[model samples]
Target: MKNLDLFDPRSVMDSDFSLNVSGGDSDFGFAFNDSNFSDRILRIEIMDDAPENRPDSEGCTSIADWARHRKRRREDIKKESVLDLTACPEEQILNCDQPDMEDCGDCGNPDEEAVAMSEESPSGDEAGNSNDSCWSMDSSTVVRVKTLHISSPILAAKSPFFYKLFSNGMRESEQRHVTLRINASEEAALMELLNFMYSNTLSVTAAPALLDVLMAADKFEVASCMRYCSRLLRNMPMTPESALLYLELPSSVLMGDAVQPLTDTAKQYLAARYKDFTKLQEEMMALPLAGVEAVLSSDDLQVPSEDAVYDFVLRWAKAQYPKVEERREILGARLARFIRFPHMSCRKLKKVLTCNDFDHDVSTKLVVEALFFKAEAPHRQRILAAEESATFNRRYIERAYKYRPVKVVEFELPRQQCVVFLDLKREECVNLFPSGRVYSQAFHLGGQGFFLSAHCNMDQQSSFHCFGLFLGMQEKGSVTFAVDYEFAARSKPTEEFVSKYKGNYTFTGGKAVGYRNLFGIPWTSFMAEDSLYFINGVLHLRAELTIRH
Candidate 1:
C-alpha cells in the first residue's frame, strides 16, 4: 500500500474555486481539489430554490444570481481564500463558453499548477479495502462505550495516537479494551471519524458532529480530524454565529495546527469590520495579555487614529486593575507598555500628559520624546520600541500606529527599511527610508522613526531625486509592512500637490525597495512644479502616511 500525504485542509480551501457564471445555467455545481485525497472531493450540485423557499423580494432573478445569493446565504465566503480566475489563461481555458468540463490551472491558489476537474465521488470500497490485511496487523480495542473493530494497521496508518496505543508496550497495547473518557453524544462522531478514516468521504450531515469528533480525534492525536474540523469552522462565515462558535471553542482546539483557522481568521474579520471589533472589546480585553496585545498592534485595527488605541488600553487597564489610586503608576506603566507613545501627535501627547490618569514615568518620557521629535532634534537619545508591540510582530496581522503629522520614533520594527534616495553625486541609489542611512543633515524621528529615501526600481527603469512616503511598522525588524501608507507631494507658495500613491511591498529582511518614480508622472510634476528649485537642484517634498485599512 502506498503511503498518503498528510491531509491539508488549505488545499481544499485555497485551491482555485470557481462559480460558473455562464448565462442561465443551473446545471453547474461547486468543485474542489484536495491533494491529500486520492481524487477531487464531491461536486456539490447547487439546488435551485423551490417556489416556496424563494423569497418574494428577489423578483425571480436569473439562476446565476440566485445561485450566488443562495451560496452567500448558506455561508459567508470571506474566510475562503480565493484567487480571481475569471480571466482564464489560454493554456488553462479549454473552452470559453460554459461547457460541461473546464480545467483552470490558476485563480484558486497562486501556487497551484493544475486544476482537477473530475466530479466522480470516491467510494468506501476504495478506502481501506484491505480489511484482512488490516486485521492481520492489529486487533480491535474498546474505547469508552464505543467498541471499534478496525484493522490495527489501517487505524495506525494516519493516527499517531492509535499507533502508540497499539505499538507501545502499554496496558492498552496488550489488551483490546481501551477505556476513554468521552461523553455519550460523542459516540456517533467517533464512529463517523472511524468511517472517514476508512472512507475518504464524510457525509454533509456530519457537520453537527464535526467539533465533537474533532476534539476526540485531537485527544487521540488524529491530526487529519483536527484539520478537517478547523476547515469546517473556518469555511463558515465570520458572522456572529460563527464568531461566537469560534470563541466558545476550547483554546487548544482553536490554536494553530498549521493555519490558525479561529485565532487569526477571526481577528482578520474583526479587523476588517471595526464595529464588530469594538463590540467584542470587553471580551477581547478578557483574553490573555498576549492576545489583547496582538489585537492592538495591527495596522488593520480600523481605528480613526492612535487616540482610539490609547482609550482602549486605558479602558482595559482600568478594568484589569480597578481603583489604581495608590499604585496608579504601576498599573499605568504595565498597560502603557503596549502603546506606541511616539506615534501620538504632539497635541494628543499634551492632552495625555495633563490628563492625570496617565501620570507615570513612561508617559512623561514619551511626552518628552514627542516634543523632541516634533522639534526635529539633531541627536536622538535612543531607539525606543514598545516591548509588547515587538512580541506581536512574529505572528500574522501587523500592528501599526496612526500619526499623520510629522511623527518619528525608534526603528523597532522587525524588518529594516532603507529608503533609497538619488545620490545624484554618485549616480547610485542609497538607502534613505531610514533617514539614518545618511548621518547628519538627515531627517530624524526623535530616537526611533522612519527615514526618507528616493523610491526607484531598476527593472522598471525609474528614478527620481525627490520625495518619499512614511510606512507603518509592527516592529523594526520586519522585512515588509502590512499596513499601506500613502505618499503625496506638496509644495509651499504655489502649493502644487500630486495625487497620493499607496506603497504596497514585501521586503527582504533588512532590505528596502524604492518606489522609483513616485507612481509615475506625479514625480515629474512634483519636480517640475517647483521649477525654480528644480533648476537650482533643490527640492522640498513632504510625504504623509494615511492608514486606511
Candidate 2:
C-alpha cells in the first residue's frame, strides 16, 4: 500500500485510483487496494484542446486560417530575405575529399595507375618526365618578379597608368607616360601634381611644390590648369628669383589667352621684386608698336605711379619714331600761328616751321600763310601799337592825342545881363553926386557881359566913383553878376574900381540923390556867341572859338 501526498506530484502519479474506494480492501477480497493494480488501471485523462484546435475566435479563429496566415508571413519574410542576384556569381558545388574512394582507370592519380603502366614508365613518367638539361638551365636562368611595396594606400589608389609607368618593369625608352619623371629634384612637383589630381587642392605650405606643379602643368600642355596655377602664384608674393625666371619666358607664352591674366601677374611680380625691370622692359620694347600699344592700353597694365609709367612711356615714345613725328606735325600746325618771330629759329618755332619735316621748305611757307591768315584788323592794330610804343618820344605822345582835348574847361559862364534906370528931372542938379551913395543892383547876365559906370561930385570936396561888372551863367542858364567899384578925388578920376564882387547877385538900393541909371546888354550882342574872351579896363577882348550852331 502507498500513501499518496497531494503536495508531491510524483506521489500523486504513483497513487492508486478508484471510483469511490473506502479506507482499505473490503472483506469480499475485491483487492481494490492493490497499489500496483490501481496504478496500472488508472489512466489520468487530460482533455486540453490542441494549440491549433483551441477556440481562437478573438485571435487565430481556425487551424487552416492560422496555417494560411503563417504561410503568407513566411512568404513575406522570404521575399524580404531574397537578394538581387544579378551582380552575384553563380553558386558552385564543391567536391569533398574522400580517402576511401578508388580512383577510376581513366584518373591520372599516380596511386590509381595500373601496375603494368607504372612499371613500364621509370621515374614516375605517369606523373610527368623532367628534362634535366632544361630544368638545370631554367633553374639557373629563371628571373623572379620583385614584389612592389606600396608605402601609402593613397598612392596605391592612384591611376594604374602612373603605377605601370613608374614600376620596375618600365624601361627608360618607354617612360613617356608622365609629363616628366619624378627625380629628387622633381619629387616636390610630382607630389604637388598628384595632390591636385587627387583632391583638386593646391598645397600652399610648400612653395617649391606649388611652383613645381605650375611647371608640370605647363610642361603637360594643360594650359587651363596652368592658368589656375598661375593665378595661385600670382596671389602669393613672388621672390626675385621667380620674377627673373618669369621674365625669361617667351612673351607669347605669357601673353596667350589662357595666360593673359598671368601677363599682369608677371608684370606685378616684376614690378615688386625686381629693382630693374630690364628684362621685361626689353621684351616690351621688342614688341611691335601696335602690340606695345595694345599692352599699354590694357587697364591692368596702366600703373598709376607717374615716374615709373612715364619712364616706360618715354622709352616707348622714343622707340616709335613715326608716331612721334605724326604727333609733332599735328602739334606744329596747332601752334604755328601762336609763336612770334626772331625767336622763330628757337626750338618751338623751328618745330612749327619744319611741319614735322613733312615737306622741305613748305613748313616755313605754311607758317607765313598762317601768320597772314591770322592778320585781322585788331591784331594788326595791336602790332602797330606795339611797334609805335617800342620807342618813347614826346612827338609820339602828341601825335597820339592830336584829336584829344588840349585843355578842357570843367566850369564856364553864359554871357547876358539885365538893367534898370532912374532919371533926374529939370532943375535937378546936373552934376552927379556919387558921395555916400549905396548902390543897390540886380541883373540877369549870361554868355558874356560887363557893367560900366561914371559919376562926379558937385562940390569940390566930393569924390569920383567908377563901377564895372561881369556876369556868368549856370548849367540851367541862370545868370550871375560880379561887380567892381572904384572911388577917387573929384579932381582926378581913375578908371580902376575900388572893390570887386564875383557871385550870383540880387540888388537893392534906396532913393537916388540926383540921378541914377542902370543898363545892360545881352552878352551875345557885344561878344561873339562862340567867342572865348577876357575883360581889360572896361572892354572885353576876344580869342578864337568855334560854335556848333
Candidate 3:
C-alpha cells in the first residue's frame, strides 16, 4: 500500500481509471465515531475490484491470508511507514501523526491548512527555493507508488480522480493507504504518467510508450496525460508506412481527442499512399473497415485510375480471408460498393476478373458493362441502380462515369481578381485587359494579339459586354507562360468561389490562343441560362490560375 496523496485533479480527471486513497493517515486519524468504524467501513482497498479488496466468498484471497501478506509486506518496510507513505517523516506533521498531537497551523481544520498550503504552491514558479514543497511532502501525506513519492495535496489538487477518492464517504475515503497495481502494459509508461502529475513535465523520449501512456491516461481519466501523449505522437518524425499501427488502435483507446494526432498522421500517410498497389498490401489489407472507409472517401487519394481502387479492394478482401476462400463474395458484397467501376482502365478491369477468384456479381457486371460502353464503343454507359445498394453506391456509380481528371495541373494563384462578363455583352471586340495586379504575357491568335488578364473595373460599369473574360497566366515582358486556369460566373465573388472555379483553360499563350475566346462559349449560350452570367447589378467573375508552364 502506498500513501502520499497524488494530488493532481487534472491528471485524475483526464484518465479513465486510477488507483487512489481518500483521507491521508492524518485525515483518517481524526478520532471519528468508534462505533461506526465497523468491519464494513474498515475493509480497505487497493482498487475496488482488486483480488485483495474483495471478500473470501467472492473467491478472492481470504481476509486472514490478505492480512498476513500485508503484515509481512509492511514489516519489509520501515516500522514508521506501516500506516502510509507519510509515516516515514511524521515529525513535521501538524501534530496529527500521534494520537495526542495538537494542530500547529493557523487553520483550525487540519484538512483546510493542508489544502491552503497546496493551493498556494511553494515550487515550480520559484526554482531558486531550496525547500520546494514539490520535493518535500509532509511525510504524513505522501503517496507511495512502488518506490516513487508524490505529494498528496498536489496530486489531489491536480487530479479530480484523486479528489473524489479522498472526499468523505467514498469507499476509499477513510483508508490510510491504497496500492496501485500497474498492469504489464502500463509498466513502461507509469513514470511518464507520474512526471506529468507531479511537475507538468513529460519527456519527449516517452514517445515509444505514447499509446500505452494514452490508454493508461484514458483509464485514469487523466486528460493532460492524453494530451501530452497525443502531442508526442503528433510531433514524431512519422511516415505513412509507420502509421499503420496507429490506424489499428482500438477505438476504445482513442479517447477525448487523445488519438487525434495519430489520426491526422494516418490520414496524411494513407492518402499519399493510396495509389501505390504494393504499399496497400500487407499493412493496408490489415486495416479495419473504418480505416478502409477513410482512405476511400478522400479526394487526395492519388491513384492513376479507379482500377487501383478495385485492385486494392480485392487484395484487402483476399487478405482478410486468406484461409476462408468462400468468404470473398460475402465480404465483397459488403465492401465492393466503394469501387468506382466505370472509372477503371480497361486493362485493370480485365486483370481483376481474370486473376482474382473472389466474385462480386454486381460489381463484376458493372465493370464488364462499363468496358463495352466506353466512348469509342457501341453502347452507352450504364449505372448501378439505386435499389441495388445504398445511396453512396449509386452516387459512386454516377461519379465513376462522370469523373474527369483535370486536363491541366492546378496551382494556387498569388491573389484573386474579379472579371465581370457584363463587359462582354458587346456583339464584337468585347475587349478587357489585366489590371496589372496580376502580370501578363503578350501572345497572338487569328493574327490578333491577346494577353492574360483578370476582371477589373466591373464595379464601375453599369452595363457592359457579357463575355470579355481573360483567365490564365502571368507574364513578364517577352516570355509568355502557359498556365492552367479556371473561371466561374458568380453573383458576387464570395469566399466559396475559389473552390468552385468550374471552367478550365490550358493553353500556350501565343499558339494555343485559337480557343482563347476565354470561355469560348458564345454569349447566347450563357444568355439562355441567364442566371449563370448575370445577377444583382453586374455579374462578378472568379477564377484561379494553376500550373505555370
Candidate 4:
C-alpha cells in the first residue's frame, strides 16, 4: 500500500515538490542539472532607482563623505534582510516616484519606512499607504522580474534561511511559488548567491562584486559563502581605500567570524603603513574613524611619546566633530582607551585633568589611575603589565616609545636625593650585545639635569664584553658639581635592588661616571638564561643620587 501511494500520480501532482527519475550530464549531478527536479520557483522583482535622484547619491569628495554614505546605505539595506514576499498582493503595482521621504519634512519618520518595508501588510491599501518606497513593484520603477527554477533541498542545505522558510509550517512554505524583492544593484549578487548555493562556486572575481556577494550571503545567513568571499578578498591586493572599506563595514557584518580574518589583515596593513605617525600626520589627519582607530591601536607606533598620541587624538576629534558634546562623546568612548594613560608624562596627564574636552568624572578617574600606576614599585608595575589581558587591560602595557619611562622617588629631608628605577626586557638587553646603548629621559635633582645609560662595554683588562651602567650630567661648560652615586640591581633568590657599585665623583660639563662592568661578569654569563640578574626576563636597576652638601 505504501508503494502504491508513492506511485500515485495524484499525490505527486498535488505536492509542491517534484521527483525526477532522469539524470543529466552536468558536474553538479542530476538533481541540480534537471529543471524538472526543481521544487520551487523564485521570482525576483528588481526595483531600479535613478542614481541622480537618490537622496544619498551625492558624489563623495572625501573619506568622511564616503563613510556617511556607507552608514546610510547600511541602514537602508538592513530591512532587505528580512523581506516578507508573501505579504504583497498579486494585482497591486507600486509607483517608485514617491517623494524622497528622507528629505520630506512631513513624512512621519524615515525609520517608519524601514519598519513598513520589513513587515507584512493585511491588504494592498495598507502596504501602499504605509510607505511607498523603492521595494515596491510598478511599471515605471520595475526594471524586470527575473524567474529562476531552484531546488529547495539544495538551497536549504546551504542556508538556514531557506531551511526554515521551507519547513516552518507557514503558508508560504507550502506554496509552489515564492517571491523576493530587491534593488537592481543586488540582482547580480543574488544570482551569484543562487549559483553558489547549487555549485558551491562563484563566477564573480572582482573585489567590489565579491563584497556584494559577501553582504548578500550574510543577509541570507550563508556562512560558507561568506567565508569564501572573505578568503578571495584577502588574497587580492589591498589598497588604503579598500582596507578602510573593510574596516568600516557594518558592525553586523564585521562581527561574523567568517569575515574577521579579512578585517584583521586590513587593520594590520593600515597599522604598518602608518607606523611612523610623525611623518604621515597630514595623511592620517584626513582619515575617518575606522582608519584612525586602526592606526592608533598599534603597539609599534613610532611617536615621540604618548603625549603626541593624546594631542593627535584631540586634534582629530576637533576636526571631525566640531560640536563639543559629540567630540567629548567620541573621545570618552572610542579613542581614549588607546591613549595608554599610564605611559603619558605627568605634564600631559595634568593637562588631561583640566581639559574641558573630556568629561570631568572620566578625566579625574584616568588621572587618578595614572598617578597610582606611577607610584607603584618597579616590580609591582611589571606584575601589572604581565597580568593584564589583551582586551580590557591594555592601559598597563607600554608601547615602543622613543624615551623609556622611569620611576623616581625624591627626598627633600635627606639632603636632596632621588632614587631612579629603570627596567629592561631580556630581549632589549640582548639587542645591545657587542656594542650598543640605551638612554633614559633626563631626570632633574637640585637644578641639575642627569640621565642613566645602559651599555655593552669592552673590559680593557679582560678584553671581553660585559654589561655596564653610567650616570651622566647633561650640562656643559665650567660648572662643576659633586655628587654621591650608587648603582644596584635585582637578582635571583631575592628580587631586591642589591647595591652593585657605589662611588663619589665630581662632574664637569659633558662628563659621565660609572663602572665599566657593573655586574663584574662577562656578557655571556650576565645574559645567560640562568643568570641571577634577570628576574622573569626583565633586568631591574636602581640608581641613587645624592648631592654632596
Best by TM-score: 4
User: Which 10 residues in a row give candidate 1 its minimum summed lDDT?
Assistant: 92-101
Residue 32's C-alpha lDDT in candidate 2? 25
The numbered model that scores best in lDDT is: 4
Model 4 weakest 10-residue run by lDDT: 18-27
In model 2, what lDDT does residue 252 have? 31
Candidate-wise lDDT, in order? 0.40, 0.30, 0.41, 0.72
Ranking by lDDT: 4, 3, 1, 2
Q: Write the per-residue lDDT of candidate 4 for residues 43-147, one digit (tens) a residue.
A: 555655445323232355443454455565765565452443234323212222223323445323422221111222234453345234324434324456665
Off by over 4 Å in 3: 1-169, 183-185, 204-206, 209-212, 251-256, 275-294, 323-549
Scored by lDDT, model 2 comes in at 0.30
Model 4, TM vs. native: 0.76
- What candidate 4 gets wrong by more than 4 Å, as runs, is 1-34, 52-140, 251-255, 390-392, 442-450, 460-462, 472-484, 502-513, 547-549
Model 3 — which ten-residue stretch has the worst lDDT? 38-47
Estimate, for each residue in 1-549, the C-alpha lDDT of model 1 and write its tens digit: 113222222222222321121112222112112222222111211112334333311432332343333344333222211111223222111111211111423113312333454332224352233122111112222212222223344445546544544454432243322323222333455555666555533453333445545644654555655666777757765553344344444333323462356556766654454433446666666654445554564565644445567777777767766766733664464556556555554556777777666766657876786566445421121223223335553221223322222333334244322221211211112333212122111222222334344443222443434434333232346444333344554323354545446565543234443354453444334445444323223233444432223
C-alpha RMSD for every candidate: 21.6, 50.9, 19.2, 10.0
* TM-score versus the correct structure, for each prediction: 0.41, 0.22, 0.40, 0.76
